[model samples]
Target: MQRALAASILIGAVCSVLSCYLVLKGWSLMGDAISHAVLPGIVLAAVLGLPFAVGAFAAGLACALLIGYLKENSRVKEDTVMGIVFSGMFGLGLVLFTKVETDQHLLHVLFGDMLGITPRDLIEVAIIAGGTLLIVLAKRRDLLLYCFDPQHARAIGLPLGVIHYGLLVLLALTIVASLKAVGIILVVAMLVAPGAIAYLLTDRFERMLVIAACVAIGASFFGTLISFHIDGATGPCIVLLQAFVFVLAFLFAPRRGVFALKRSNSHSAG
Candidate 1:
């Protein structure tokens, strides 16, 4: 249980960091789609008897690149393209699952349990999370610039294509690494909710990242505890805890909270 909780905390912190940028850049649904798209990869890996994460990551990166390519060259809106891609990939996953006749694969991908996590899994998560953090931190300036103004980045000769695709690769790895604890279905909630809540509280990117990581870590720890006590599913419990945090942040956060807005309005009127 201690190991499970520790792993959850680590995963949560990692997801929080990536999610801030994802939410800010309006790529939240992209994360969601990638999460689902990896399902077929996992199934295929199992059939081939290969490492599941590798297969999942490869599939996810493919989907991300496809989406990026389509968005850039086609007149179709990004969301619409993503919707079509998500549905097709997810459908393929379902078909693969039925063909494989592996019940565990489907269950694990959809609703993973804390008890299912192992030391090896935790270590894999750590390595992926650490490497991703280093890359993101090293390229923070470029990423921030690209996120805010891609045209400016292009004008400055920043290789927008490389940076854009790199971010998606990192996102795919993060989702694959997080799958064990939150499962593919609920991982997006973990990725987006904390960041969204933090965004409502701060305009500065650094501060938002800090707050988002804290919220995600806190929710993971508390949710794991609650899941243990109540004998419930850990993934859903964590998601619910995040929702609670978001609610509190939305209602009480200084700059964007309901009370804060009312106070500001009243002071202006006064």
Candidate 2:
């Protein structure tokens, strides 16, 4: 349980931090895409007796690069390209899963066994999450500028290529760390919801970062506790909690919630 809690905290913090950029850049679907696209890599790694992280990272980077290339070369939009790429890779993964002979560990990749995390698992989570968090902090302002206005960033002499693909790589790393904590399906929620809810509640990027971290950590801790009490799946519980919070922020947040928007509209009419 302690190991699970530690892993949860580490991943929660990392996901929340990166999610601020995801929300700002509108790359929520990219997160979803990479999360599912790594399945084939996991399966192949099992077959070859390699670390699943390396395979997952490679698959995710391939997906990211493919989407970028298609979007840049073709008239098709990024979202459309992402949908085709991730779904195709995910289907390939499902086929591979049927052919691969593996232990129950594979099940954890799909649904996550939060309480089943071991000491070694904790160490991996720590290193991945710690490294990702540091990179985000060190390059936050530059990244935020890149997210908001790539043209302006490039005009000011920033490396557009690095910022663009660097974010994809970071996203892959974050998902790799989170796989054991929330699985592929629910990790997308962790990567989107906290930052989104924070976006609704705050106007400043720094404030968004702090609020997102608090929300994710709070949800992870309490969700684990509630899951244990109710014998529910911890990943789903944590995601559901974040979803519930997003709803509240959507409906009732001070400056940007639905009610607030309606009130501002009314004032304009008056």
Best by lDDT: 2
Which pairs in model 1 have colliding backbones? none
Per-residue alpha-carbon lDDT of candidate 1 for residues 32-103, written as tens digits (9 for 90 to 100): 999999998999888888888988998998898888889889999999989989889989998988878653
10 residues in a row with least lDDT, candidate 1 = 100-109
For model 1, state the Cα shift of residue 253 in Å: 1.4
Q: What are the Cα lDDT values of the candidates? A: 0.88, 0.93
Stretches > 4 Å off in candidate 2: none
Candidate No. with top TM-score:
2
Backbone clash numbers for all candidates listed: 0, 0
Q: Please, what are the lDDT tens digits per residue for candidate 2 over residues 169-201?
A: 999999999998789889999999999999999
Looking at model 2, residue 69 earns an lDDT score of 95
